[model samples]
Structures are given as C-alpha cells and as structure tokens.
Target: MFKRLILVLLFLALVFGGIGYWKYRQFQQMTAQLTAPRPPATIASVEAKRESWQPTLRSVGSLVAANGIAVTNEVAGIVQEITFESGQRVEEGAVLLRFEDSVERATLESLRADRQLAQAQYKRAAELIPKQAVSKSEFDIAKATFDAAQARVAEQEAVIRKKTVRAPFSGLLGIRQVDTGEFLQVGTPIVELQALNPLYVDYALPERNFRELAVGQEVQLRMDAYPGEAFSGRVSAIDARVDEGTRSISVRATVPNPDGRLRPGMFAEVQTLLPQRDDVVSVPRTAISYNTYGDFAYVIAKGENDALTVQRRQVTTGRVREGWVEIMKGLDAGETVVRAGLVKLRDGQPVTIDNSVELKDAEVGKQ
Candidate 1:
C-alpha cells in the first residue's frame, strides 16, 4: 500500500509539473509578442512653397484722442443752465453752459446807456475846441470824461460775456460735474471734450529699433477690443529724444476712425512695415525647430530605392511676420519640410509620410 501511495504521489507531481511548464511557455510567448517593435512614428507634412512676405516689426501701443481738453468755468457764479448734454456733439463757439447772469446783464445795459451819453459829450467837446468857443482845459476835461466812460462800458460788456461758456472746438463733451444752481469757483472743471474722428495711437519702441522707423511709414494696428480687425495707418511722428530712463523712443500714428468705434485709452498693437525683399527664401514657422546651438529645419532628400531621407539644414532667420519666416541661409524655396512629429526625429532616421493633417499657424495674441 505504501508503494502504491508513492507511485500515485509521483504521478500527481508529474501532471502538476507539466501544467506549470505549459503555463511558463505561454507566458514567454506572450512576453515576446508584447516586446515586438512598433512601426516608426509616422508624421504629417507639407511641401514648402516660395511666397512673398513683407518684413514687419510688431509692437504694443494704446489709442489716444487726437485732441483732448478739459473744460472749465472761468467765472465764480451759480450754474444757471447747462446747454450741452453729457457726451453731446458740439460745434465751435456753441453755448456749453450759462452762469447766473442777471446781475451781469443789468450792469451791461447801464454801461451801454452811459456810453451813448459819453459819445454825445465827446462830439460836442471836439466841436467846441475847433471853434475856440470853450477853453482848451475845458475841452480836455470833457474828452477825458468821455474816454473814462467808454472804458467802463467796455469792461462791463467783457465781464458779461465771461458769464457764458462756449465750446472751444468741435468735438464731443464728457460728463458734466456741475448741476444747475451749483456754485462753481473759477478754474473748476466742468467737463472734458475729445475729438475722435482721427484717432492717435502712441507706442514706445526701443532705441535700437528707431533706426528702422520713420514718419510716413505704413503701419497696421490691432486693438484689444476688436479682435481680427486690423486698422491701417501711417506713422505721423517720432520722438526726437530717446527716454534716458528706459532707452526707448515714442512713436505716434494716426488711424482713420470713420466708424467712431475706437475710444481713448484702448490698448492696441502696432506693426510697422520695414523694408521688403523682392525674392527671398522662406518657409512656414513650424518647419524649423529652434535649439540652443542653432535653428534647423528638416529637408527631405531623395534616397536610393524611392526612400526619402530627412536632412537637417542649419538656417539663419530674418524678419518673421505673419505665419511665415524668412530663411536667410542654407535652404531653398521649393524643398519639402516635415511639419508634424518632429520630436522623435534624428539626423538619419527612416520616416514614412502619412500626411493626413495639415499644419497651420497657431499664434494667437495674448492680453
């Protein structure tokens, strides 16, 4: 019975060992399948084409009113009436506000009557002096009296006109600070006026960039309020003095605001057009990868057996504007560049082209 038990145990052990060996073989086969190499990463690409791209320098700026003035009251009096509404369009010499002018009007009328009397007296004094009917001293005293009265009348009339405020220029008025019956002191601010038909944009650029900028150069403007809308203008002025503190120079441009949508203090971006090249080699910005050593782009070279090999070409860059960049050296216009999946690229790695997705410009301005 013991011998029979030993044989049975040995048979059971052999069966279990066989099962373990079969499982181990299956695991090894599965491991080998999992470890098999994957196909090399395929990338989408675009053929490079030669195109005309103007060189441009882009900078940030802000919109300002062409003419800005603070309106103030010249006389000390209670506000009687405000002729202009806040933000109302006014013409030059239009009545803007009126002070309490009852006393001034009365004084002006009294002065006018006195002035007429003085005119009659002066005429009689001249006739008497010519005829020698009156003494010279008497005629002189009469003339002096008439002149004094005329001066008084002129002063009173000037004072009366000061009570009413008139618009200095044609523009839109800002908020009103004084209401009717409110007494305002002299030089107190009443409102603000701004002319907005032709808006001014002011930007500061570094002194190094001043050499390329000049008056009458064409510029494109982009505002934070209006996305995708590029306003065009020409540079109107450039500051003669560079700011000593910041080493920058101020630039001003005039943009046509026919729609009157642009307002003062709106932040803007300004792009000045530099010199353009007649024929230049350029490529899409995505084709080039920048490293600490240099900027390099991938160019496909025809290999044996219809295989395309990527060659890394070192390039020098110039003014990059819009979506394209100018390649100053080491590249031809018609070469093909790998657009996507460049991260895993090497000097001589074999690549398969499966260009299904086209790469486009992805630059969006951030505030």
Candidate 2:
C-alpha cells in the first residue's frame, strides 16, 4: 500500500509540471509579438495654405418677368382684324388687334358736321352782337351751343381710338385668342405680353440672413434645365416687410437676358455672395470626418525620421462651397492635413504620406 501511494503522487506531479511549461511557452510568444515594430500606414495628405476665397450663400428660387401685362380690349365691338401673330415681338404702341369701327366712325363724322354748323351760327351771331344788330341774349345762346358741339366731337374721338388695341409696352406677345369678326366685350383679354430682355428672380431669405443681404449685391444663378452653367446678376429690390408667419423677406435680382433665353416661372438656384470674411479659415471638404460625436479631421504633425503623425482635430465648419468648407476654428495656416484614407485612422495613429500628387487648388475649386 505504501508503494501504491508513492506512484500516485508522482503522476500528479507530472500533470502540474506539464501545465506550467505550457503557460511559460504562451508568455514567451506574447512577449515577442509586443516587441515587434509596427509597419507604417499609407495615406494621402495636403498642406494647408491661404488663398483668396469668396464665400457664397446658396438658395433655390424661380425666374420671373420684370414686367408682364395682359392685353385686353377697352371697348366692346366686333373683332375686325388680329394684326399681330402669336409669339411675335411687338413694340410699344404697335397694333395688336383692331375692332370694327363702322359705328364709331359714323358717330365721329356726325358730331363733326354738327360742330361746323354751330361754329357758323356762333360767328354770325358774334358779328351781329358787336354791330348792335342782335340782342346780347341771342349771341350768348349761340356761343353756348358751339361749345356743346365741340365737346361732343372730343368724346367721340376717344371712343374711336379705343377700337384699336395696341401694345402698352414693348414685349413678346403670347398666343392670340380672338379671331376676325368675333365680337368682344370691354375688358376682354386679347393676348399676354411679357418683357424678357431683363429678367427678375425672386426668392425668400430667412430672417436670420436678412442682415447679410442688401441692394446691389452680386449674386449667382443656376437653372436645372441648363446644368453646369451659371448666370450672374445683382439684387435690384428687397421687401421692406417680413412675412409674419414665415419670418422671411422676398428678394428680387435683375439678370441681363439679352438673348431672351430665360423665361418666366423657371426654377433657378440662387447664390448670394456676401462680403468677404477677412479672418476666416477654410479647408478641403474631404478632410472632414463626420461621426456621432461631431465633425473631425486629422492634421499631420512631424514625427521621427521626417515621418508624419496624425493628430485628430475637432473643427467648427461654416458654409461649404466648391468642395471646401470655411472653418470657424480648430485649424491654422501652414499646417498639413490628411486628405484621404481618414476612415481607417485613430487619434494618435502613425501614418506615411504618399504625396507624389498633391491636392491642387484648381481641382478643388472645380468641385
């Protein structure tokens, strides 16, 4: 029994010795891994520099006509002729439509004959009154009759002029609605006239931005119909009162439309160029990293052997224009920053920059 107990003790000792040796082997492997040097990461970066950048505020709006008028008949008559074609350009005072003036012309002629007869009677009566051949009352009655006939002629002339419908202003005529010999009533719409040489763009500005806008400020305009094209103009008018419900002010800009390509009611994107900020800093938009915490970017700092160290920075960004953002704070001039590959990075991670092709300011401007 004593010999059996000694053999069992030896077996337990062997098991414990095997476990300790295995643990020692694991420790040695971990130690070697910790001592090994990590490889440098590949990344693209750009150097911060100062450039003249004009900031712009962007909004959406629509194109409108500066002056649009609906041509209507002033007198009720039969439509005699439509002198102008649809979509035709007409000058001020050009005839648009003509109503039948047979009745009006006859009335004018009849009043003229009566005026002539009254004038003869008045002349004859004046001669006799001065010579004491006729009484003063008879001469006075003749003079009054002459004046009434003259007034009747003037009234009929006005009615005849109203028969001819003329363009009130120089503009392009819309579709013609009346035909020859068709009877029209007073105030009936004949056609629409729109002046397109100079266009007006209307948009609403938020109450907070009201202070930034002013008369004669330069603005940029873009239409979805013509992509990649930009039109320039200036603010011509601003609403004096703000809307009580929306708290927004209506703004109008005058754009030169010499070619008459811009039409009324076209959707447009507007950008107001506010005054340049003297103390604002800006950065490429790609440098910014957005997360749950906020927006962040990695700035390159010098490390050992001229290598770069990435230090994460929190930035307060303002307006973004042409793929660049105006930085309110958290960055400075002459600093270097990582441009790409920022997703696979940390606060203090080491990075190796491959700047064979640097980020050009012109390329960034195009975006």
Candidate 3:
C-alpha cells in the first residue's frame, strides 16, 4: 500500500510540473513579443534654418475707448423728452435730453417784457435830462432800474438753456439711464458715451525692456472675442512712472477700430515687435516639447541603409514669432526636427520621415 501511495504522489508532481513549465514558456513568449523592436514611426519634420527673426515682446493688455465717459446731467430737472435712443451714434452738440422748461420760458418772457419797459423809460429819462425836463437824480434811478431788468432777463434765459442736455462729443451712446418724466438730480448719470473709432490698449512690460519700448513702436493685438484676427497699431504713449510693486512700465497703444468691432474693457494679447535679428536658427513651434524639467525637441538623424532615427535633444528657446520659435542653443542650422507626432516619440526611436508637407520660413512672418 505504501508503494502505491508513492507512485500516485510522483504522478501528481509530474503533472503539476508540466503545467508550470507550460505557463513559464507562455510568459517568456509574451515578454519576447513586448520587447521586440517596434516599426519605424511615421512623422512630419522640418529643417532648422538660419533666418532673419523679428524679436517680439509679449504682454497682456486691455482695450479702452479713445474717449469714454458717462454722460451726466448738470442740473436737476424732470425728464420731459429723451431725444436720443440707446446705442445710437451721436454728434457733438446734439440734443440728447430735454427737461420741463415751461415755467422757465414763461419767467423769461415776463422778464423780457419788464426789460422792454425799462429800456423805454431809460431812453425817455436820458432825453428829458438833456433838456432839463427831468431831475439828474431821477435819470440816474431810471438808468439803474433798466440795467437790473436786463440782467434779470439774461439770467432767466440761462436757466432755460440749462434744462436741455447736449452731447459733449461725437460717440456711441450706451443704454439710457433715466426714462421720460423721471426727475434727475444734479450730476446724475445719463448714459455712457464712447468714441470707438480709435481704441486704446493699455499694457505693461518689464522694466528691463524700457530701452526697447518707445512711442510709435508697431503693435499687434489679438482679442479673445475675435479669433484669428490681428489688429495693428502703434504705441501712442508711455507712462513716465514705473510700477514700484511690479517693476514694470505701463504702455498705451492706439488701434484703429473702423468697424467698431472692438469694445472697451476687452482683454487682449499684445505683441510688440522689437527689432529683427539676422542669422538666427529657428524651427516650427510644434517641434518643441515643454515639461517641468526643460524644453526638448526630437532631431532626425540619418543612419545606415538610409534609415532615419530620432535623437532627443534639449534646446534653449528664445523669442517666438508667428508659428516659429528661435532656437537659442542646443541646435544647428541644418538639423531636421520632427514637427508633428511628438507624443509617441522616444529617445533613439526609429522614424520614417514623410516630408510631403514642410513649413517654410516665409510663412513665419505672415503670422
């Protein structure tokens, strides 16, 4: 019986061993499949070339109207008529609002009638005094009364004019603040008026760039509201004082907005062209990969059998213009760089260049 038990045990061990060996063999085959060399990755690439690069300084800015204000009432009165509609274009001296002026007009008329009577009395007194038909004291008193009456009439007319509100300048009007028959107090807000033809952009730059900044420097502006559209302008003004807290200088540029598409208080991305740099190596912006450690780009290297391989190369980048970036270091003028398909790229990976489409240097400046 013991001999039979030993035989059964040996048979069980042999079966289990075979199953384990089969499993081990399967794992080795799987590992070999995973470790095998992958096929060459197809990618688009561009040759790094030395070209004249226009250095640019980028900053954030805001759009403002060339002339903007909140229209307000100078004198208090009940609004009898709203002469202008909301969002209407208005010219300087255009009547915008009219107040109740009936009482003031009546007062003016009464004062004018009194003044007419006083003038006649003064004329008669002057003639009589010259002929000794009236006393000098009586002539003097009549003249003073005539002058006072004229002054009162002028005052009444001035009061009547104050009841009407006119546009101070030509601009687009905002929403009306007060309705007809609504009484408004002095200095009450009426509407917003803004000159929208030439908009102003206010931006700040680092103090180190003060030397490069100046009036009349060319500026390109991009607003989120208008995608893929670039508005051009020149630097209009530079603030005299530098911000102490941020150590940046404030700048203002004037941009033409003939169609009134740009609005005040809109955020903008500002790019101020500094000066052109000659003989600088540049490549397509897509060739660069940024990470926390640093920036890098994949360079295509030629190998045996005319095979292509990508070598990971670290690069120091500088000013970016249009869709291209300046390579300040770690690259040469004639090296080919992978422009697309960087996500799947690895160091020393084999690559197949499908250079059917390549970026030209001329396209950089067009941006």
Best model per lDDT: 3
Query: Candidates sorted by lDDT, descending order?
Result: 3, 2, 1
lDDT of 1 at 122: 78
- Model 1, span 225-338: residue lDDT tens: 889998898999999899999999999999888778888889888998877767877776777787676888878776778776677778898767566778888787778877
Off by over 4 Å in 2: 1-41, 131-140, 276-280, 303-307, 355-367
lDDT per residue (tens digit) for residues 122-191 in model 3: 9999989979999999999999999999999988888888899999899999999999999999999999
Return the TM-score for each candidate structure. 0.79, 0.80, 0.70
Error of 3 at 65 (Å): 1.6
Q: Give the TM-score of candidate 2.
A: 0.80
State residue 172's C-alpha deviation in candidate 2, in Å: 1.6
* lDDT (0 to 1) per candidate: 0.82, 0.85, 0.90
Candidate 2 residue pairs in backbone clash? none
Global local distance difference test of model 3 = 0.90
